[model samples]
Target chain A: MAKSRVLVVGTGGIGTMAAYALEKGGLAEATAVMRSNYDAAIKNGIDIDSVQWGQVKAWRPTAITKNVPDVSKGDVAPFDYILVTTKNIPDVPPTVADIISPAVTPGKTAIVLSQNGINIEKPLIARFPTTPVISSVAYTGATETAHAKIYNDDPDCQKIGAFTSPQVPAATAAEAAKRYVNIYNPTGTLDVLYDADVAKVRWRKIAYNGSMNPIASILRMDTPRMRMSRHIIDDLIIPIILEVRAIAEASGVTLQSDLVDVVIHQDPSDTGFKPSMCQDLEKGNLMEIENLVGEPVREAERLGVPAPTLKIVYGILKGLQLRVKEEKGLWEAKFQSGNSYE
Target chain B: MAKSRVLVVGTGGIGTMAAYALEKGGLAEATAVMRSNYDAAIKNGIDIDSVQWGQVKAWRPTAITKNVPDVSKGDVAPFDYILVTTKNIPDVPPTVADIISPAVTPGKTAIVLSQNGINIEKPLIARFPTTPVISSVAYTGATETAHAKIYNDDPDCQKIGAFTSPQVPAATAAEAAKRYVNIYNPTGTLDVLYDADVAKVRWRKIAYNGSMNPIASILRMDTPRMRMSRHIIDDLIIPIILEVRAIAEASGVTLQSDLVDVVIHQDPSDTGFKPSMCQDLEKGNLMEIENLVGEPVREAERLGVPAPTLKIVYGILKGLQLRVKEEKGLWEAKFQSGNSYE
Candidate 1:
């Protein structure tokens, strides 16, 4: 029997886990691609110590590709699943479309975006007009401690669906959603939810993303402080959440109003946890600032809805990202510290 | 003619300059009180390198006092002027009243508050009802370089008046304002605007402090990035200004609508300037978070007006301050960092 082929791009903590889960579940033969940590990941494979999913020791992928061209074109077998776990930033080089293009093997590929933020699937969908694309929202307390090594205290569900932007839950049929869920669910490693209301779910996740990611990152503090901060929740965090809800409503998605309360009072988070944005910031690496903060803010602004909290937060995080990227020289362009593009 | 005695408390960068300006201005026989930099200030006097104001080398005070009692009682003549320059954090002990109490010698002393934020004079005003109190707004490009030295790039106006909070600008008559101005104006170093509308000006300054101070501090960013942040100015800063204006109007002062524009665009805040809040955070010292961010937020909340931006920013900053203060353990009360009282 031939195992299904899955190529996971952006092999950080999230990608590593998805690859590990897929292979361990006996659902597919997974391949991973890495850039800087390529040699380490290729040699060491991935080691994730997750409380929920027990232990996966040296779970190497079936194949390792250094670059996207290798994963997309160099491989003989067409990938059944192409998972992108990188940040979805606009304008920055190597757009997700560019990275995932070579792997779009028509009938064979199912482009699954298991990244953060909302409405991100549109651009990738636009690029691959005919290819089946799946939007995913992964909730896991996971962070990369070292090359190919992740330490997760808690693990949560990953929601996936076959829906485009402005597409509501009712519009998205269950066939692709079921197929996407089936790929990773058998592992019993994670709670995989087949989401019909992916737009709402994405927006719901974004409510958390917009509130937690940038604010926590900027404060350089973690979830415990943020969750316990009545002031932060009542004044800062909730307003951004509500604003996201309003933006969603304006865009004709009826999100559950209690989502704000859910995000605020959630446990384990109250015990203090750092989101990926904060984690990346602490490491002085580039953050998903544009995707998590900028995109929603601009979207709300475009819809004539005012999201003051997100706007300012986005500005601060953008400044931080620019400064970090500049200092780390992670990318080509450099901005002088304390200076901006005037 | 006998010299009029002046006592200056809190010799940080702001306090250092005010002491220098008072001495160099020859307005009074100035005595200074310092906690951390007492010996340095006593040995070196105060050195100020100014962009607008000329140099002042070893500008010694009439006397240097370490404690308020020393300044209030150690000096021979009664203090005609009592200047307090530390932050006004509520319930933090050594409140503004505590710092300037001994000098509140009935009519013999005129209490002057040249600190940042709004209605800071209320406590001192309440303590000495009969004493003439002056409120001041100093616009200076200065940072404490050495123990007793401040490097000031620009010397701007010091706006002063004698009025209580909720008092309209039109009601302010500036006899006390004039006298206070006479003391600091003789330096010919910084421009001194005897603001009749000190209420409006203070509110306007709060518009800046409430927005820029906490945001920048939490982000650990400075003015150029903060200023270059269009989203910050347009979305975060402006909304806060408007909210403050609404609160001001609710409190019976209709601030000029253009104050938002002025705060966002007009200030000659030197490039790469870090607000006092940011400076405080960097030192891991206690911040004026409660006063600068908390007070107005609570005030707005009390006034039945929603100040979402201020509330959230206040929350994040308060968290940062609590965390920093806990770690520094400058005083006894430890806020279980990352733990909420609830």
Candidate 2:
């Protein structure tokens, strides 16, 4: 059997980690594709620190920058599996589609989405009707320090499976899963569950993120504080979780347990974690507001369910996002005015 | 006519400023009441900075602590006007009622509430149905420094009126207002509007405070930055103002202009303009949540109006309140635990 050639899109913290893991597993020849020329340069020269498997020996995989690799140059092969690990922002889906669409030949290509949240899968399917796109739920606490370091606090396994229609061969999906398991084997923590009902897992994770991330971010306080404070748990967090659960149920996703219990009660002191939402705010990056909280909230409204608590949290987070944009604009204006004065 | 003897409760910033103003204008003979027993000691050796009127000549009012001036003192005359400028918390009403209720004679005694928020009036009326209670709005900003210094910024005028039902005698209310104007002949400006629709004015101030204070407090950002930044204004501030207006309209309190205009478009360079709500948060004082936003929102609900914006702002503020409490508890716990360990 020929070794599967895997193309990992996005070379951020998660993308780099996944690529490194795949290379280490020896199941496939992995190529890391980044969006920027600077990113490509950094990947080639910079050493990526791995929290799970010590640094990957300064290993440099075949790196590409542009979305459509030059097929005439005969430098790239069609990918057996394309793992998309981009952040769920507006430009991500289109960018992924542009980059991976050419390489996704029918029956041979399996596109796995390892980002947080749902709804992105349908769009990918719409863009590439024949490509087998597997929607995976990734639960890990990881942060990239500089270009080189990826720190994973949770080290919990990643779960991958087909979440939508366009039935790909079960063998192909299994091969992709096997490749992931082998790559993540050294960490010995990758438990990739292939469920026909991937929506449940996605919804469950959404419930957790929806409840914990926004509340933690808006409060500008820690998770332990929220968990210990019954006031927050009862008044704000629980109600938000319930709201998310309602939306999930309406969308045919059954949540098993309360998200508040899972997130808040977990010993947050061990992680000293700030949610990605907070990171986005601090970095002045556009938050995953629409996909995570806003979309579900809209869905809840459409389904005639009152998501009062979720709406409040979403409003606050959205407000924070706008504030960030305004501040950035002011900064840019000030910069321009100073330049003019100069 | 004999000069009206007034007991000015709460010798903090507002109380001292009002006393100084009253004394300067010859509105009434005023006595300053302090909750602490060191009143005379602090008074005997006066700190010029502590006086609200800055350096003053003569006309030092009598200073009595709670224990020494227990209402039953024989020489104490029935207070014609009791100006209560205490912090507006849950305990304020009952505390004032306990100390001043005995001296409040029907038709003669008038309690001028110089506190923030509109909720206190209802409780005061409920407690002492016969004693006349007038709601007065003060625009002059004052801060108490050291023992005797009270600094008044620019404005010298206070708006006084009979705002609620079972209306006090028009003549008595006018008499009280005249005395207040005379005593506090504030240098900058003075206006006494005797409209029965004073709730409109109260609501207007509430609208401004409700919009600016909590956000300023939570963000710990200056008013100028908040006002100038579109992100802050459009996202956090505008939504809050809109909510406040909705609640005010729903509660039948007509507002002047819109809150957004007053809060966001108001000039950034205004002086002595920290949100009083932010001041409360800094002091770890119980915020006037019930009166400023909560009560009005509850009223809106009662009136079958949905105040979605107000509901979210109120919830966020409540979360902050709870978080602050939890943080304090944690700090206290750690302190105690350290002491035990030592």
Candidate 3:
């Protein structure tokens, strides 16, 4: 029997990790689409420093190309899974749907969204109408350590769920999710669970991401440092999770009670990994402040819920994002401290 | 008759401005306690670039001394008013009471607490129980432009209130407040209102301070830049004020509805001045994170009230404060960004 073939889009930490996962699962073949890093990825392959995947000095795939047309050679094999692993930043060139849409076959291709935050798969579902969409709640603390090498800390089970938004029908989503699950969990490489309630799973993961990601960025500290300061985390990190819990509750998504511990319970080894938001700011890349912090906070506010902490965190992240943009000569956004405290 | 002598302690922006106010009022002889810039003050007097008091190239006070022991002459005549204008930081040396206790007489001297946030006069009240205290809510947007020269944005009014905390009896406080009002309001140097409920007045000012002060410092922005972005202030600034209002209300101190608007309306001149927190971080001086953000947020939390916005801002400011302290050879309070956002 021919092995199931998958296409990985955007070669950041997530894309590289997914490609590696596909190879390690040993039941599928992986092809990646890289634009700027195409030559480097093809030449150097993809080096990853992860506890789960060990050290792969050079990870060369069966096939690696830039655009959709050249993703797979010959008579269009129709990719079974198109896994997107790019940063969900707003207002940048080359959106997810735009890059991954052309390659997806009407009935054969299923877009596996391995992204953070909620209400993300809607755009792909909207753009690809008939394509089955599965949301991946990636729980690993991961980052691209070097140009092509990726680092994973606190490697945990990846949660797969049928994204049943208003756009996608339940039956269709469940069927696609099952197929994706079969591919994701063959040898139990980072045990991927198929959650029927994807929204809830996404919300639960957000409780961790929204709190730790932006905070680590703003404070310029990692998970270990957060663990080191009891008061800072207890006083700060936990409260942010509580706010997110409030947001989820307001949105009528009942998150699990142990969700807050997602932030508190961490492997000290993962302490070395920087969150994606901090990486975005440092690399002068645009951030996903809206998706991670702003959107959920807005949802809570819309429901007349008090989410002051989330809102302020969103503001700071957005401010930093704007600062990065201004530095890049994209736009002009300036402010002063007004000596108001004095 | 020799004029009533006032001693302005901790010569920053507020100290410099108060000295100018006293000199312009003409009812009292103003003396300053300047340790770091004693020579500068003695040599150059106090140069002020204020909207209220035009520009004073050289305005010498009656006396400029360093310590509390030498505040007054051999007559042992206590200061008519020892207006403290220092940042109310925690876990630091020379607290409010310790710094001004030596110069305060039992019945004669009134220590005007020109500070922001709640319950700040407690220490002074504890140390000098019999000495009357007046709480001043200074509304001007001012900065210490030079060593002694201060730049004032809105030199409108400094609300004088009789502090009736547990240690202060209302009658004694009222009488002292009246005297301070006489000194503060002579020739209408600044509109000094004698608020019978000083706690309420202080709480209202916290609505403004807790929102703008730490935020300005974190973002390194002034008031005018805050005005440029409506959403940033609306989404960020107003919510923080609302949180403070919740804190105040939870503490049974009702804040005015218009308190949030205090941050919205700004004099353009205030744009250039750096807030005290920003100035502190820039100059590597210690911040008042505890008094301004921590204490109030803790008060709210203790009362089963949610003040998440205040707490996170406090965390960031404290982190910055810790960074500054570590840099200054003070102590080990360090954390790296870990490139988490990357």
lDDT of 2 by residue, A1-106 (tens): 5666777777667776677666666656777675553463455543554456665544566564446454444566677778888777652235556656666766
lDDT value, residue B194 of candidate 3 = 74
* DockQ class, candidate 2: incorrect
TM-score of 2: 0.74
- Model 3's DockQ? 0.22
Highest lDDT scorer: 3
- For residues B220-332, write the lDDT of model 1, one tens digit per residue: 87756666656656656677778888887876778776786666654434456677888888988778876676778777877898887787677667767767756776423
Q: Judged by TM-score relative to the true structure, which candidate is superior, 1 or 3? A: 1
Better of 1 and 3 by DockQ: 1
Q: What is the C-alpha lDDT of each candidate?
A: 0.73, 0.64, 0.74
**Candidate 1: global Cα-lDDT?**
0.73
Distance (Å) between predicted and true CA of B290, model 1?
5.0
Candidate with the larger lDDT of 2 and 3: 3
lDDT of 3 at A268: 40
**Model 3 lDDT per residue over A84-179, tens place:** 878776555577888786788877788898878777776787888778888888866667766676787556468887776465578888988877
The model with the greatest DockQ is 1
What is residue B81's positional error in candidate 2, in angstroms? 3.1
lDDT of 2 by residue, B1-342 (tens): 566677788776677766665665554677777654245435463333422345653336654445324444556667777888876656224555665666566666778888767666887777777666777777666666555555555454467776453656556665666555555553534453344456777877776777677677666555665654565666567776776677667777666664567556453443334677777677775566767777767777787777666666676677677655555662321211111111
